[model samples]
Target: MAQINLQNVNKSFGPGVPLAVNDLTLTIEDGEFLVLLGPSGCGKTTTLRMIAGLERQTTGDIRIGERVVNDLRPGDRDIAFVFQFYALYPHLSVRDNIAFPLKAQNLPTEEVNRRVMDVAERLRITHILKSNPGRLPGGEQQRVALGRAMVRQPQAFLMDEPLTNLDASLRADMRVELKHLQHTLGTTMVYVTHDQIEAMSMSHRIAVMDRGVLQQVDTPLNIYRHPQTLFVATFIGSPPMNIVHGRMVGARFVAGDGQFWVELPPAARQYTQHDKRVSFGIRAEDITVGAPGGAGMAGNVVVREPLGDETVYVVSVAGKTLTAKTPPRIRFNPGENVSVKLDPAAIHLFDGDSGRALLPEGWSKHV
Candidate 1:
């Protein structure tokens, strides 16, 4: 329900130790469902806790809407946090559990009942109203936790992998439910998850973090198709992007292994001028594997994984390994020589040593 902003935020566990969060600055728009995605030890959770006032930031300031809340307690932030581990009162019935937070505030019994049932219905947990927390299924108990948060109708929702404890099928089901729930309510939700799929499907925009630094912030498709860093490129996809050693040859990019052929997009070639030893990156899904002559690079199949929906092929050319994915119904096996072609427009070029993007022609005026 509010926009949040961080300015020069800093946190450290001790002197000389690495900053858990390093001069972090970000903005969360009102009613935006933003997801903080990264692997373990990435400081995403540390950032979330800092926002909630649950973890004190060693430096900088945090603001919700128009007011700075750095001096406020967690309870005063008007935000709800749904963590991985549901902290429900085991002895209480679902109805009582949902009403517990209100009870703590000493609300009248009639008002408590009104808030509890309203939240239960909103989360579709009305049927389990009377069941004790100990008797509920993981998914049901999850709803109770969510309902408890919903009871307050707080200004923001911070969920940190709340679906991590459920079975795969239930987790998937709950993801859909949660998406719909957020859509219907339109609250400012900051969800933290290591699962890229969850982040991709649920977020309006995603902030990717790594080793205490923010990597790239964009829509899922842009992050997938145009990652700003080598780490982001490697971390976001399943099968991952294939990065190869190569050098610029006049207008062409020749693989370092000395047998692969590549053509650069006319637009990308502008950056290749006066630079050699660049890193070429392409996604597994973007590479095309074929026989000796198919208007693409020539290669040989070395291995094949026949997944039900698509086939994954590992190809070899000049002793370099390249992965290509195609429709599962079409199959190819190892030991057979092949040719591959990449979509020139889809290729990404990186500064070999720096792992930073090479600006295309007309991109950097001084280049």
Candidate 2:
């Protein structure tokens, strides 16, 4: 296992077209599981391709371990790439497909058979070694593809949305299996995906991107609790954070048109004096909904969605709609007047003009 580094990377298709990746400098530590996460057209796949030597960068230095692999071919990079779709041969049996890479290197027959059987047993596919991949189920076919990559024992593994073809339940199951596999093998992995849940659940650190630019890189909890930008605040969450357009008035944030207001925490007050126009952000779970005429802002429930264990409520407060997540036991109906309380300690503040977070001094260094 080796650490991968990219310095001042830039990828552009042509003179008139926009760049696919821009000045991306990142390092993937040895034996680390790093995920490149973003929406479509965000250059995550391009970055992965560059690292695997499948696509060359217009200007940059890419080093895999101690070697500068800018001129090397994909096969010489000593890394295995698992494609999104299962790329298995129909004519070949599962055993032969997993052994194909070893055979290509002209290894001894006994060594090849031993390695294939070991990987098959580890993946629990030994029973299907004689079956054709074309007839197997989607999950089984994926395992075969993974087996093919694992048998190589390369320096690292680069995967590009490897589980996108599976159903929701299967995808969930595979996520757990893949994380366990990575931990057991202790190899460096660079995964590319647009799904936030996959990134959140599997990665040691997530590199969030947008329009070919890196947004933030942090652990799952830090990324969720303290997003560095507005884009991250809205993108990483399942229900998304509730955003209210407002301005800072003294130590309090007053909604536009002067309909609603909330006090800022002591730490946030230091930065509020300079930036008058700010956007107030709070997570769905941070807002409390109760009966009307309480010690909080007054609002009316606009819609209610029951989601088994929990319910999500759409509330209209001061002519602005905000979402609140609550337990299913706490029931409320549409058009019902309710008291909404915002947790000041859990609130996030962002500069309205720049869309950057307004955080305390040196707050980002800890994470």
Candidate whose TM-score is highest: 2
Candidate 2 stretches greater than 4 Å from native: 361-367
Between which residue pairs do clashes occur in model 1?
Answer: 297-340, 298-339, 299-338, 299-339, 300-338
| Cα misplacement distance, residue 207 of candidate 1 (Å) | 0.5
Error of 2 at 336 (Å): 1.0
TM-score for candidate 1, residues paired by index: 0.93
Local lDDT at 13 for model 2: 85
The backbone clash count of each candidate, in order, is 5, 0
lDDT of 2 by residue, 1-367 (tens): 8999999999998898889999999999999999999999999999999999989999999999999999999999999889898889879999999999999899999999999999999999999999989999999999999999899998899999999999999999999999999999999999999999999999999999888888888998889998888888999997999999889888888996778888776666777774389998999999999999986889999999999989999999988899999989999899999999887778888999988888853543433
RMSD of 1: 2.7
Candidate 2: Cα lDDT at 364: 31
Best lDDT goes to which candidate? 2
lDDT of 1 at 45: 94
Q: Candidate 2 versus the native: TM-score? A: 0.95
